[model samples]
Target chain A: MPEFTLWDIVRNLLLAARWTVALSFIAFLGGTVFGLLLLLMRLSGRRVLERLVGIYVQLFQGTPLLMQLFLLYFGLAVMGVNTSAWLAACVALTLYASAYLTEIWRGAVAAIPRGQWEASASLALSFGQQFRHIILPQALRIAVAPTVGFLVQVVKGTALASVIGFVELTKAGGMIANVTYEPMLTYACVAAMYFVLCFPISLYARALERKLA
Target chain B: MPLQLDFMSILVQWPLLLRGAAWTIALTAIATLLGGMLGIVCAWARAGGPRALRWLVGGYVEIIRNTPFIVQLFFIFFGLPELGIRLSPMTASILAMTVNLGAYATEILRAGIEATPRGQIEAAESLALTKAQVFTRVVLPPALKKVWPALVSQIVIVMLGSAVCGQISTEELSYATNLIQSRNFRAFETYIVGTLSYLGLAILVRNLLYWAGPRFLFGR
Candidate 1:
């Protein structure tokens, strides 16, 4: 019966933006840690480990995040493992981000010339030492730009967590619109918030890419 | 009691699942055709059109690229009606998908277009070719070929993204899965089936595009 102000919508959305930012950070950081491990496994020179990780990456990348979210949220509940939307979203998105990150880092690692490996080996550097000192340093430089660019994707991807009822920016917009009868304004605010979050990263990524090139 | 998995219960709704997948493909097909054309036009604008047009196209690419597709879809579906422009869910879904793909493809194709050798265009011009002839005969084909793999990947992404269109009740595969789950209370099984179907679809679509892009699009 009461009217909702523009400030009210923007204010509420700003509050919800924190969750979006938090979720993205959690997913990105968690994915990066796990993805680095996957990268190590892939580069371990063991054919079986490499193929296992390849299937893992494919399984995550080949399916929709929405399906992954649904599977986790509902699957967990069905298994009588009480889970909240937040927990489920975190798990699903972390896995999703890890898959892409692993592939990206692998490409960067692969870009390192094979000579780097042989040179390190000839110098009596152990496998871990070569990877730690020789390979990863060079690969990290190549990896930075694309990895930053991929953050935009992870941010955009967090929007899907709203499907499972995680009350991030997108879900908050829907809720506000439903309550205020102002779908246009609410969603515009939501989109604007996303833009504000994403555009600068996009620009920075491009700048880093050009700088790297 | 231990958890038990059931697949046959959801698999029985094969017809509904098929219909939903048909709609997803139909929506994607329409969007891909329209969106690919839109991308080319916008790419041309960004690459070679007038300065003002380039700015306009650039603005569009940045805006669409920065937002999530679901928000874009929601805006088109729910927000437009307030402006007295009502769209069916299917119409809005296709429109959203096309716009999303167009923005992404514009950037992708512009990269290809910009990489076109200046000498090639100059050579075509000296040979008395018109601007249109130069673009069509010498530029677009190779530009597309150079970026075909990226384009195909983007198309597959849009296809998988269409699953969200079901959020608006558009009767896509995810929508059918939701329906079957609600009916049978087999939520996990229904979504599992739906996910596998989407995985299969993504693989199939990617292969088809890769196989077809060279033969049909840019030519040998």
Candidate 2:
């Protein structure tokens, strides 16, 4: 067996950490766009749209994300649509992040006082206009801190993509552990990398919450 | 070719599914009990203990919260053996989950405890109650009532997270699903059943906690 040093494990894991970063970026971006769409649908004042979005949120939130990853990765293959772990992890994480983002953004929107809506509507603004001009701006401000906080969750969540064989940080750590026979050292390095990635965002989120409050 | 979904092939293994679900619930139950107690102690320490102890507990909370649960599980299961502490997969999973939940609960419960009005504590102190009595009787119940919803959500998250324990072959619900799928090659169907079962369990557990919190933990 090739001798592996601590530096070898850390360096390789750092390289693999890029994929974790990339996946989180994609999932957060996709989740934001998709979650916004779902949020609008829920706020659309149509009963069917509202209920549909509610069930969608409940369905995603109520299940294990591991199951979602499995369903997307394996389910797509069974459907004869060629599937890669990258595609499955991206899609699954996007959907998972969307469900959560929608809820967070929804709460932010709901926090807007009823008077804002009433005054906007009294101006004869259309529902779309009211949301676009009056509601969205205020809601976005309230949503920013929680949204940033959720990014930490997204980053940590990419660790799960390892199980689907996407070979990001955790997967690379597993590979290195096997080679070095240093499961303890390797996994410790893995956790440290995640902490380095996530802790700053978590602190920033806390700061934002304090500022907003 | 048209898609034909056959869930029966997976459902036919109901016994395995039931056992898997049972294990999942059992693991969650044990973790919740142990972790809740750990959380209370740590919260008390952080809220009212000495400066050094508070700093120590704060460090523990930050480390656990910032990392992913899978990595934590791997460390306990795979890493600890290097220190001459070999644990079975089940024991490792339970310990990991308890530790994970304890950290989050400390934060959640501390929020409630800190929100306690100074006047109430003073009143209890005037009655000549001990510190422990003050916390348990005059402070804790209301604090718990205040944060019950957030605590319920965290518990549900931890329950769903226990799915990761299967990665180390803990034979939880996901493991059972994996086993059945490997046997029948019904990966998609088995996962659907497994995912929905988790959804059912999440909802059930949430409701159960919401009910039990008032009736048992803090009173109606």
Against the correct fold, how does model 1 do in TM-score? 0.98
The lowest-lDDT stretch of 10 consecutive residues in candidate 1 chain A is: A58-67
**Model 2, B11-45: lDDT tens per residue?**
89999999999999999999999999999999999
Among the numbered candidates, top lDDT falls to 2
Query: A76-137 in candidate 1: lDDT tens per residue?
Result: 89888889999999988899999999999999999999999999999999999999999989
Backbone clash pairs for candidate 2 read none
Q: Cα lDDT of model 2 overall?
A: 0.95
Q: Which ten residues in a row have the lowest lDDT in candidate 2 chain A?
A: A1-10
For model 1, what is the alpha-carbon lDDT of residue A138? 96
Can you give the TM-score per candidate against the true fold? 0.98, 0.99
* Model 2 stretches astray by more than 4 angstroms: none
Q: Evaluate fnat for each of the predicted models and list the values in order.
A: 0.85, 0.88
Candidate 2, what DockQ?
Answer: 0.89
DockQ of each: 0.84, 0.89
Q: For candidate 2 chain B, which ten residues in a row score worst on lDDT?
A: B1-10
